[model samples]
Target: MARCPKQRKKAVIAAVSAYLELLFNFINLLLRYYEALESEQEQAVEHVSSWETPIARQLARNSFMRCIVSHGDISCTMLVRMNCRTFQKLCMLLRDEGGLRCSWNIEIDEMVAIFLYTIAHNEKNRQLQATFRRSGETICRVIKLVLRSVLKLHSILLRKPKPVLHNSDDPKWKHFKNCLGALDGTIVNVRATKENQERYRNRKGTIGMNVLGVVDQNMEFIYCLAGWEGSAHDGRVLRDALIRPNGLKVPRGYYYLCDAGYSNCEGFLSPFRGQRYHLKEWGGRRPRSPEEIFNMRHSTARNGVERAFGILKMRWAILRETTWFSTKMVTKIVNACYLLHNFIRGENGADVFERLYVDEDPDEETEDVDEDLILHIQPTVEWSDFRQNLAQELWAARSWITS
Candidate 1:
């Protein structure tokens, strides 16, 4: 449609203006839609956050802590495996000596309580998160943190052994003069990679670590060596412990009573091999010979280590079960258990677990000591003669008493 030049130009200008107006209207509509969407998104975020407000979380945490603190000794003891007084003292010691500080959202007591609850119950991170009202990450971090703090107290918590004196009147210990304590090895289950599992497997076909524990007559741990493979022999582990710079220290002329798994060396006293060495075997019968009497007394004195191990396992459920933590962490947990055991024994008067679990008669069966395996230290002639002489003295003393 050819028209006059001025009329065509006016029509073209009007059409262009109409198109521009339409474009502006479309842009305005899009801007309004985007603004409405952003407002809705903001409202949705607020709604989600309102479900767990800071005040609400704080209240929940406070309520949980109040239940632990206010509820009597049974609640605290069952949960943390320690009475309220001991738990509070432990927290104070950790804060003052271990340098554990309260975090922004958590107190030191709460952190320690979390760690104790986890170990006492062998709880998983998810379980801890639900119980403590924390995230898994937070639970993991605090567990590790509290673990490290407890470890720092090893030097102070570990008891120093006092050798049995010459004039000792305790019937069980009086015979073994200059004896420090009893040392033995036990298997503790651990989780390892498939590649390393075979190395950790013990003769019983269990994947575990061999833990060497030395306990005084009072059933307090004096020294502990952990992390050895379960396949390791008790003597081999003891040798490693002796050679290490910070290993067990046995004074000159003093010895530790050991099971027949160890050699009768200079500083270790083991019962006569091929003889009745267990107290159960001596039940309902008097000693028929010097060796039997000596063995009976040795068994009585050395059973303290067994009781200590039993109490340790009974108190800490983590030790009884296979730990799911890494191998390194499991070792630390074992050490922590030893430390706590000593602490509890020293601090708590009349331990309820000890009263309940420790058998007064101690009729538990003993494993047959391996007589064929070569030990790190070969049996010494002098030590053997000394044991014979000691047996004779014990038999003579008993005969005099009967006479």
Candidate 2:
């Protein structure tokens, strides 16, 4: 193996170079393996994420389905404020008539259920998101869509008033022939911008909108006007309603019974001022005067509107509280509530909300009419005489019954 010195040096250099080359190749292979492993991990993570989304969505949908189907009708009513049958019918109406279509992930029934649950319970967006297993944006969009759909049914939902006929045998309305309904204004809470808050501040010093509602003897709303500032007098609101082209319409002879807050105009009847009115004032006591007798009967007959408002507020919790929507949206919601109320009353023979009001008077307090405020439409002399004659006739009828 002995060799020359230069030859041996050359052989050692070649061996060292070969070793360095082999080391470089081995390092390249290790880098390629590491990159491949990292790519596989990323693909695996993407697959899991994509797979979990649909699974989670499916689970949420299944849970909602179980709540609707397996929980029974009581739970359904408790959740959405209506029986299952009514809920289904409402959904069908919205789809068939209202042009409501289902979203990719949510069904028509689920969309309606979301809206009903939100209004019935006044649930917040976050709560709705959690309950419906949707994002907050999705929840808000669904609410608006369903609200529009429900409002589209207003024409059918709002009842057409049938005046009390002359041959009416019902004691509550027999005394007042050709009476169309009862008209009153209620203050519904609303949240407005800082600049508009003062205008909405009512006499009670609360931010609200004065809602004018006209309901028939059956407690069905015939007309509704909402969005007037609370500080606006009821008389002022009524005046506006009268002037609007599509506003409250009164037949020539038919009249609506109103509290003294309204003027005793030609088509509106108001009880005598400076006299004891309201049923509570005459409870368990005989009417001492003809005026008192008239006021008692007037209050009893007009109680239908009050009870309708009570049942409406009780059924929909959103009406009882300040809504988070904009002023315009709140007005729409108020109208939608009225429409739903009429629909429920017309469809259901037995209403749970109405039952809760049996033998119970509404909590709304009556305020004295501002004579000066209502001077524009002064009490017509003819209508005043008619009221007096009616009062005298009622007094005589009471005496006859006693005798």
Best by lDDT: 1
lDDT of 2 at 11: 99
TM-score of each: 0.82, 0.82
What lDDT would each prediction earn against the true structure? 0.85, 0.83
Off by over 4 Å in 1: 1-51, 361-376, 399-403
lDDT: worst 10-residue window of model 1 = 361-370
Q: Please provide, for model 1 over 49-166, each residue's C-alpha lDDT reduced to its tens digit, 9 standing for 90 to 100.
A: 4327778767777887776778888888888888888989999999998889898888998999999998899988766766777777989999899999999998899877687878
- Residue 227 accuracy (lDDT) in model 2: 95
Model 1 pairs in collision: none
By summed lDDT, the worst window of 10 consecutive residues in model 2 runs over 361-370
As for candidate 2, its clashing pairs are: none
Clashes of each: 0, 0
